[model samples]
Target: MKSLTSIIPAPPGWYARWRFGTHRTVTYPITTWALARDTGSEHTIVVGVDTNGMWPGGDDERPGGEFLRYIYEPIEAGTPDDVFNPVKSPADLASVG
Candidate 1:
């Protein structure tokens, strides 16, 4: 998997066959979220995936798989946070590994 900071744009529907162990098709941009781990904080990055394998668009040459940066509020330890919970960007979060 590409690092969150290194995720550049790519063609649409490109992630359809990107491989997620199973034959999973990323049809919607809301299909998944990246959970970046850290010691004090964690990040849930919202992303978009191919709805169809066909890359139909006016800008075929432009990078695809582009996503909006997800902004959220900070969470204290022992607090519950869902996918929609607010948190800092992955770039600001330092990883344990």
Candidate 2:
């Protein structure tokens, strides 16, 4: 899971997957929104997501899983002024950790 800032929505467009034989192709890019954190008390779906987690490819190319980032609004902030803070980016995540 990449950092929230690193989590970017897919560009608005049609992405068609090839069909097999007479099967219909799925060409719509579904947009999804969510959040990830180092810790959380509640989650809408699953939990314990390691943003730094990775998945090895069959050819051993990119091992950082199918996703490169995770997007989400913070539940509670680090401080009172943090509520208005801009979202963080991958470079920002690199600086923090």
Candidate 3:
């Protein structure tokens, strides 16, 4: 897997994407998750995981498993939570979309 914005390498059963946001005149693409919102984090961290249908580990609109996104640091991601926590500013949310 790879980060959506930075194309950084990710481990198997793991993936990374950015929150729908904006900063300093740059706008980040909108997504569905409670990932990092800062510009630096938006570019590097913000990750999640997934698996085949039988293992129950996917999170897109797809059926079976769910790939849970996160609100964690780039260096640490030992826990897993799937609560959709909104972290972007109202303006950022409105503007990015």
Question: Highest lDDT among the candidates is held by which one?
Answer: 3
Alpha-carbon TM-score of each model against the true structure: 0.17, 0.20, 0.19
Tell me the tens digit of each residue's lDDT in model 3 across 1-97. Answer: 2223422333322333333323211211223322323344534444333221111122343332232232333336432332222575767534543
Lowest summed lDDT window (length 10), candidate 2? 49-58
Worst 10 residues of 3 by lDDT: 49-58
User: Residue-wise lDDT of candidate 1 within 1-97, one digit each (tens)?
Assistant: 2223222354322232221223321222222333323334454343432333222221331244333233222333322122222254655322311
lDDT (0 to 1) per candidate: 0.29, 0.28, 0.31
TM-score of 1: 0.17
Model 2 per-residue lDDT tens digits across residues 1-97: 2223223343333121222234222122224322433334333332222222221111332322242223333335222221112456657534431
Clashing pairs in 3: 20-30, 51-57, 58-65, 58-66, 58-67, 59-66, 59-67
Q: Highest TM-score, which number? A: 2
